[model samples]
Target chain A: MKRILFAFIVVLVSVSFAKNASAQSEEELVQICGMIAKDATFLKDFRIKLDAGDPPPVQRVPVILKKDVKYRFSVCNSKDFEGKVVLQLFDNNRMLATTYVIATGKDYPTIDWVCTKTGAYHLFFSFRDGKAGLAVGLLSMVEMM
Target chain B: MSRRLLYILLVLVVTASVSSCKSCSNSDDLSQDLVVPDSIAFNDPVPVLGETVIEEMMQNIASPVETAALIKGLKVPFNKDFLLTTKASEKFNTSFEKSLALGIYGCDLGYLNMYEKSSFVIDYIQVIKRLADDIQVGQFFDFSTLKRLATNNENLDSLVTISQQSFSRIDNYLRESNRPMLSAVIVAGLWVEGSYLTTRVAQVSNHKRIRETLGEQKTILIFLLKVLKVYEKDPSMAKFLTDIEKVKALYDDVKITYEVGEPEMVEEDGVIVFKQTDKQIVEMSDETYQKIIDSIQKLRADLTKF
Candidate 1:
């Protein structure tokens, strides 16, 4: 009986710690972003959260890009979320750059893009396999030409 | 033993249920807690865009730093004459007025920070803090840290980054609190001040890049008008909208045409750098550009009135 009680308590404690370790808030995401965006001018940050569903929808953020400017797109995903963030920068129908490379099944934490044209660009965010994801996307200006 | 086991099972079930519920709602609780006061009614007879879309537009507004950087790059001397007087902040009584002044001062602060004018920076920061406090968004600005950073010339980059973050945070907070109207006003104020500074400089310097930059604002002004028009029913915003519409009238003549070009991607230091062959062609007569400058100046003067 004592062994049973000890086993249940251990399970509960482990479960509690696991949950605490995984859950990440926006404040935490901002802290993560501070390190990633160091030495760069931060323009804005997008906080993204999507609940688990049969088909998760992609989140799109629109930004104005100027010519001859270098921009850094940095993303940090929550540990609690199984879905790895796939961020794509699009200008109308043209796909400029993405964080996830499908060819090698590789992912990157940042996409450093230089805008050669001045216009509206959209950032589309989703997770691999349409799974629910929580993350933050930070846009910063690295250089201006 | 069975009773004790049953108790453990009940406890486990309750704990699991509670924890799961808490985890699911952790992201949105603060936004829910912000209750809009009964004073200002947002009964939009014709809501142009949803709250979420307006919030996105607010995020996309060009940072004042970008304009200031471009102005500095043009070698235009940092003219303190162009900035709004910090003493004028006291004249803004209403939240609407305070929010707008907050953004106006924010743009001046960015300009000051860009030029690394540490001497005049403290006054603008203090006024910004006062205006932000008046509107309940003061929490975002770390006044002491900003002050300390302002004193040291070496911390220019840090000062700009932190101030940008603070303004962004205030914007996000306003949207989260369901006060997007205020957010729109703040953005408009920032844009107005930024345009005033640019157009004033353009009036004197007549630089091609400055003129091109002013022309680019045609698109930004259109987007801003869309956001501001949503709050037209509010008495205070009605006058603001009317004044801005006059500015927009001038922008209608500024033509921006885009040429399609392919984008090239190059890897620099293990990171992908994208270059586009596409280009935007801005066309505007000198007369029309002058008209825009005059209209923007008029609008800014009315906005900054005591």
Candidate 2:
């Protein structure tokens, strides 16, 4: 009887902590969404949350990009999240642009791409080092060429 | 008493396992509520467009602000005559009508912001707020802040950013709430108004870029039609489907071929930038372009009518 009672108490405490953690992550994302450049028009935002494990899980978002348009992609990580974000733009199976450079082990907060082809494009978001994190990716139109 | 405690333990364990996974599925299962047919009852589940496809189509719809900015760049004069009157907002009785009008006003707001027409923006914003409220998505719009930004010329950029963000929030909320049908309608409204503005501008200006941009709508139209078809089970959607399909038929002749080129990557300002090398070639004769323009104009007219 005592063992069952202890297990129930443990479960209750875990649920409480989990709920608070999720809420804080959301609040962190909302607070940092205003970091777009002055000349750019905010188009959309993609919010991602992944569990920590080997080979961080990726979230894919499909978007249409027009030819001759300059677009900016920026990402913000939650303050409590240990993992940094890696945002990549892809054309079908071909990876086009990414925020993380594997050679130098560096990550950028933003990427600027000038699209020459008008079609469906995908955005893949994940974290470095297989770490659990919460992040938001912002897509903005920088210019039209 | 011991057996009761064990039962409680099992229930608690199951509850904790289910509730503790904070990062689970991101999308709600909207197919059952949204895609079910009203005319006939079926024991087996009916397969329809997945929520992810709907989301992609939603995100892919071109923003009105981008088109308006292009018009501004082209030095085209801001013509208030092209805008739908705010009075039309009151005429929309159904959720479909109100949502579509909400999208139209959203585009018009974008145009007003792009042209820096501060005087006419407040009226549109007010109507948008009313329409959004009717659809239960008005909470996304921060009216006081938007009005404050609209009234000040120095805050035009901020006004544009906030307004666009508000629409994005509404889109997210609708998808999350299993109301993607309304969300799809809203985007259709935005696209129609945007295409109308472009075609109208194309009539007078000999701008090659504008014509190319207008021609590219062929692809977007196909995507929009596909998304709308998934929601055709709704009684209110038949008229919308018909009108949009007519527009799609008109876009059939628009030829958009591409030229493949070598992709380039360069480091600019310490950032790795990849410039897409393939070029899009939009080929449309004057006659085909004119037919598309007429079709779009009529469609927009029908949609805006009470």
- The most accurate candidate by lDDT is 1
Q: List the residue pairs that clash in candidate 2.
A: none
**Tens-digit per-residue lDDT, B73-132, candidate 1:** 889998999999998888898888988998899999989998999889999999999887
Task: Judging by DockQ against the true structure, name the best candidate.
Answer: 1
lDDT by residue (A25-142, candidate 2, tens digit) is 5524643655634366788888888888777788888887877778888888887779888998888788888888787887778778999876788899999988999888888888
Which stretch of 10 consecutive residues in model 2 chain B shows the poorest summed lDDT? B24-33
State the RMSD for candidate 2.
6.1
Give the Cα-based TM-score of candidate 2 against the true structure: 0.83
Segments of candidate 1 deviating more than 4 angstroms: A1-22, A52-56, B1-58, B152-154
What is the Å distance of residue B1 in model 2 from its true position? Answer: 34
Supply the DockQ value of model 1.
0.44
| Predictions in order: chain A TM-score | 0.81, 0.78
lDDT of model 1 at position A130 = 78
